[model samples]
Target: MTLTLHLDAAGWREHLQSVRNDVPGLVPVAKGNGYGFGLARLAAETSALGVDTLAVGTSLEVDQVRAGGWDGDIVVLTPWSRHDPVATALLGDPQVITTVSRVDDLTTILELNPQARLLAELLTSMKRHGLGRADLPALRSLAPVARFEGWTIHLPMRSPDPLAEARELATAAQAAVEAPVWLSHLPLDDYATLRSELNVEARLRMGTALWLGAPKTRRTTARVLDLHPVRRGERVGYWQRRASRDGWVVVVSGGTANGVALSAPTSAASLKQRAVALATGALDASGHALSPYTIAGRKRSFVEPPHMQSSLVFLPGAAGVAIGDEVPVELRLTTATVDQVVDE
Candidate 1:
């Protein structure tokens, strides 16, 4: 048995249809481990959704999407440069669209392939990528030679009011290129308002909200492979850390290799959330930590850091679990990869 992801097909289908209906021109984003469903799997789902376009993060992922028999148009979100030969080659594909954040990249793309289809990305408050408002004139100059698909606004995860921000950026994007605007992380309720206020054709590029918007539709679990009775103060795991109490040491499938026991900086907004993050950071400073594995309806502490392919979980002596029993696990989908994904 291995770490597995289970999908409630009927519920998932209902949610998918609901989103598809809500967002008339929804672009399903299938990148970054395909939100832990794999790239090819999401591509097939995108096709089933009957959308004409799909967005990916990198050029290498374009091939994987195509391999999934997705013949629809593909737009790579990451800006491309001469430094990326693979991405350039991928741009030669008729169906592949590129996003140009810098003026020079646009020049390079046009010089190499004047027929290239492109999107001019306007720098949002995110500041991660895209051309600034000042770069709009230069983008307009290069607009003639390049086949301009639209403009894009990559919004931040938590914006005070994304609709207001999008409304503000709409003017800059429209001035730069007289074309439609594509955005990410925009809420469904504000779609109509964004279009009416901005007076532009806005397309929503979604990944997490599309795949994981409804948490009740999916479940992830790891199987118990072995169990060992441990005594208090007995050293365990690779670090040889002593157990605080007598408990059953449980080995469960899923570890660092599968993106278990891995973490990212917290995006907490509230003061209480920040305090919890600080506490979590303090615990991480020490060798002791908690694992994602849930045993007996409670998350168990790790004996040590996870191994490459499995983790050691500590369950109290009174707790009971047989080998091969599947336990629930909460994982970050973007960072996670599983051996199997079962549609139940």
Candidate 2:
């Protein structure tokens, strides 16, 4: 039994090239399960793209990128910390560009490596990390001692006017230090506009939009391991809950270990969406949760919470599916850990 991701290799490559063409100076981001393709695979793809730089989430990923055949510059998205041994150890590597957010971190980094290459991140609307706008001028003093490759601003994914904010921050950053501007989450048109409007260079660091942009190019499937006929009120699963209707208890590959039935916090913005979320939660609380597996073109309900390597799906009598069949699975790609990836 296997949970597999199938790829339309030709279509995926075409989409990747299209994004690269649209976004000039694109720094492809390969981090955090590598957007479901895995970090090593993404690093290899990044090498194929021939970009000068690749951005990973942490210094710990640098070795994986190197092992995957990426021999270019690597920029760690997480800000440098004096306490992180991996980050500190990478200080001497000229090809690794460390992101410095706080003024004190910059001081600490410089104290350790006098000529460490750095990317200064200014505080954006996201406010997750970065040095405050008031601290921008402080980078000027440290610029001489260290190599300031660029200034970065991580804008929010949903913004009314990302271009305006990016332009403002990029302007401020350029004023403080004469270096290229690196941006995240800015729209394509806005990035182009900002790049043209700004004095120094501007580069877009893209993750989801770069790798998983074309949904049609990939498919996920799980193999049916076993099936058992069930009648109404029949006990099933580990909880031995009574079956509500006549159906087949279908065991399929993919479970909690592979991120099946695991959900990220919902970003329910509207009242209707929030109400739907609440109703879904109510159903889950009642042990009537919908499974991601689709059998005979219909989504099935879970017999119980997923086990480590497989799930029990309640397939009603209306659907016809047998063991050993490959069924489609709808899941958030970023969270899924599949057994294999096949090029179709």
Q: What CA root-mean-square deviation does each model show from the true structure?
A: 1.3, 1.1
Residues 240-302 of candidate 1 have per-residue lDDT tens digits of 888888889999999899999787767898999999988877776775577899999888888
| Weakest ten-residue segment in model 1 by summed lDDT | 191-200
Compared with the true structure, the alpha-carbon lDDT of candidate 2 equals 0.90
Clashing pairs in 2: none
How many residue pairs collide in each prediction? 0, 0
TM-score of 1: 0.96
lDDT of 2 at 145: 81
lDDT of 2 by residue, 147-247 (tens): 88989899997778998898888878778888999999999988898888877888899999989999999999999999899999999999999999998
Candidate 1, pairs of clashing residues: none
